[model samples]
Every structure is written in structure tokens, then in C-alpha cells.
Target: MNANIIIECKDLGKQYKTPEGERVIIERMDLAVKENEFVVLFGPGQCGKTTMIRLLSGLEQPDRGAVRINGKRIQGPGPDRGVVYQTISLFPWLTVMGNVEYGPKVRGIAKKERREKAQHYIELVGLKGFENTYPVKLSGGMKQRVGIARAYCNEPVVMFMDEPFGALDAQTRYLMQEELAQIWEKEQRTVIFVTNNIEEALYLADRIIVMRNCPSSIKREYEIDLPRPRNYVDPEFLRLRKEITGIMDKTL
Candidate 1:
């Protein structure tokens, strides 16, 4: 598919006021995310990766500059951009279907239509038989799948995910990673994922954006030129992983 710009962040900067003084987190960051692209922002904790995601999703405004989605300015969170957080921030009280339908319902979609839409994503995330289960009844990985279903149910143009698999155990994380790849392969929505895991970033991203330390900026971009169903032991894949790990180790 030909790449077209779907999201643009220009001179995006963000700061927080500390008791001591103002602490700059991101500065003059310019990024363009093409449609149907899977881009990962890789950095250690507190390195402003999530902050950048929030900025792009319009959850928080930048201290300076702006985020534009398909040539239109993003003023605040809308149904067009959906987000999944590291913690699987689902409402404990809502059932799986309820959670998935929340977005469309809030947007005034009719009850029957929202239910059908939610069911579509529930099935898409492989939770068809567990539609009525509450968050508390689900496993960690299951809960994250609900979050993914909820995000996709609204048919968002872009999906911003912050370490959606971070909380799962090693085995579960790997399973979820493969599942995510399958979902993205079928759906083909623009995804901006944030993670500190170099391997995870490489496995899921078409391009990886490596960010610098506080007052963060894009340091390097690795366009993963590997074939689908990429083998971990492939020479090129291994080389890129080692190279990215070296850069991360140096920065940390």
C-alpha cells in the first residue's frame, strides 16, 4: 500500500512544573506517521514516550506546537483516535461488551448498533465467548485484549497504545504480541505504540522511533525492512536488535 501521512506532530514540546522549577520532557519534536503504519516509540521509563503518545492523541496539549490528524488540528480527545494504556485501564464494573461499546454509545450510536459493533471487536480480539465477563474475572492478558477491543470498536483512524503488553508475564506477553500482529495485519489501522522493550518494538513496528533522555527528541529511526512472519534468528533482525539494544544501553 502507498504511504500517506495520517498524523503529524510539529515542534511538539511538553513541560511539567516541579516544586523546584519547570522540567522539560519533550522539545521541538517533529514526527509524521503514515496511514496503516505500525510505529513504535522506544525509550526507558520516564523518557517521555507516553507523554508523546498522549500529545498525539490529544489527551494532553503540548506546552508548545501542535498535533494534526490528517491535516486537521487535534484539539482534544475524540472518537477518531483511540488509546490503550499500559495498565489495561478498563472499567471494572462494565462487562466486556459494555466496555467495548462505551465509545460508540457515548457518541450516540444506537444501543442495538453499538452492541453489534462491540460484538464485532469482541470477536476480533478472540473474546467471543466471554463477552459478558467483567474485568475482574479476566486474566491480565485477557483484560488487555478487552482494552484492544474497546479501542478498535470505535473504528478509530489511529490507535495509540502505550506498552499494552507490558504487564503480562513473559509467556503471555509473547502470545499477546503475536495476537497483536495478527490483528494489525487484518485491520491495517495506523498504530503508534510506545515501549521500552527493543525486541517488542522490532517485532511489532514497521518503523521504530528511538527517543533521547529528558527533554526528549527523536534520536534515530529504524525502518524494519524484514519480511512478514519475521524470524527472530534472521541475520538482519538480530543485527538490528543488537544495534538498538546497544543504543539503549548507552543512553540508559
Candidate 2:
């Protein structure tokens, strides 16, 4: 493994047993993500992008090959990886502070220390004044913010975001994208983000890995060299978007 590569997977494969037959989702996939690099896995629906994230994050075991993190084989979930899902699942009963501090609290960090750390993350995610607010009161975007803060509080070496803004309204989605970019700039982490939206991928990723239709494998990889806070209307951005879209499998 390269010293700069925080996560690497070689010839990884996965399949599920269905009543019809075995369904292969990933095949002969190999990838290496460098430290603090934000990589986006972009592909058509049901192309196994989520499955790739699961395998890399140790949420699901691959049928063949292996995933390594920091030169060690990934056996299962550990503190080094954190995940933010499309649907925000905050503890309804817990306040923003409570939910953000939950991970450290469970790990037995001192209350004062954990709260301070959680407070910092809460502020980082633009939720400073909402410490006592419960999830029920938060708008969809705010809820996701809390979710991000909670994940960041754990100080994971890598963050796996599976279409984290997919559920939001278009305006909210755009806002969240900008906010996420700012957050990443402030505190860098190795992030593997899965998204079907080309604009979102272009805006957030340092590199975009396009996957083939299931049983998915890398179709192509693009290094996005655009300046930060990308404009959707930029000529180069639009050109790349059209080119990538042209190669994607059309969904029925």
C-alpha cells in the first residue's frame, strides 16, 4: 500500500443469493484513495456504488479480494471510519449536543471534554445555537447538519457519505453541497462520497470514479481540477458534465 493511500481495495467483488440466482453487484474492482482526498463514486442507479462504500467501510464483506486501510486489512467497522446516510437518523430524544457527543460518550470520554469537542463540531456544522434543539424541530438540511457534526465528532480517518443530500429539496441540496465543501476545506478527511448527480460530483470531488452498470466496475476516472466552489455554468464544467453523461447507461 502506498504511504499516502489511506484506503485501498484490490479485485474486490460481491454478490447476493436471490431466488432467481446469484446476483453480482461488484466485480474485479480496484481503487486507492489518498489521504484527505475527496473522491466521488458516480454511476447509474443500482450500479453498486453503495455496495462499494459498504465494503470499503467494513459494513459489508466482499465475496472476494480485500480492503486495506492504513496498510491493515479491514476486518470490520472501527473508529477510523464514519458514515453519513442519505436519510438523516438523529436520536429524536436527544438534543443536538447529545447526539453529537453520543459517540465519544459511549467510548467513555470525560463528559466535559466530550461536550467541548461536540460543541466545536456543532459550531463547525453551523449548529452552534441549536445545541438543545431536538431532531424533530430541525428542517431536513439542519438535521443533516447535525448528522455531519455527530460523525465529525468521532474524528474518523475516513468519512463515507452515501448520497447524503439526495433527500433534500433542490435548493437545499445546493446549499448543503456548498456547506460541505467549506467544511472539508476547514478540516480535511479522506472522504468517499457516492452520488448519482453529476453536478454535485463535479462540485465536491477531487476525483470522480464512474462505475459501470451492475455487476459494477470502474468505467472511467476523471480528475476534477476545477477551482473550489465550482460554477455549474462554467464551460469546462458543462463540457465535462455532458461528456460523462453521454457515457452513462440510461435508466428506464
TM-score versus the correct structure, for each prediction: 0.95, 0.98
Model 1 lDDT at residue 246: 80
Prediction 2 global C-alpha lDDT = 0.94
Q: Tell me, what's the RMSD of every candidate?
A: 2.0, 0.8
> Pairing residues by index, what is the TM-score of model 1?
0.95
Cα lDDT of model 2 by residue, 179-207, tens digit: 99999999998999999999999999999
Cα TM-score of candidate 2: 0.98
**Model 1 per-residue lDDT tens digits across residues 102-181:** 99998999999999989988998899999989899999999999999999998999999999998889999988888899
Instruction: List residue ranges in candidate 2 displaced over 4 A.
Output: none
Best prediction by lDDT: 2
lDDT of each: 0.89, 0.94
Candidate 1, lDDT over the whole model = 0.89
Q: How many residue pairs clash in each candidate?
A: 0, 0
- Which number leads on TM-score? 2
Q: Relative to the unseen true structure, what is the C-alpha lDDT of residue 142 in candidate 2, on a scale of 0 to 100?
A: 97
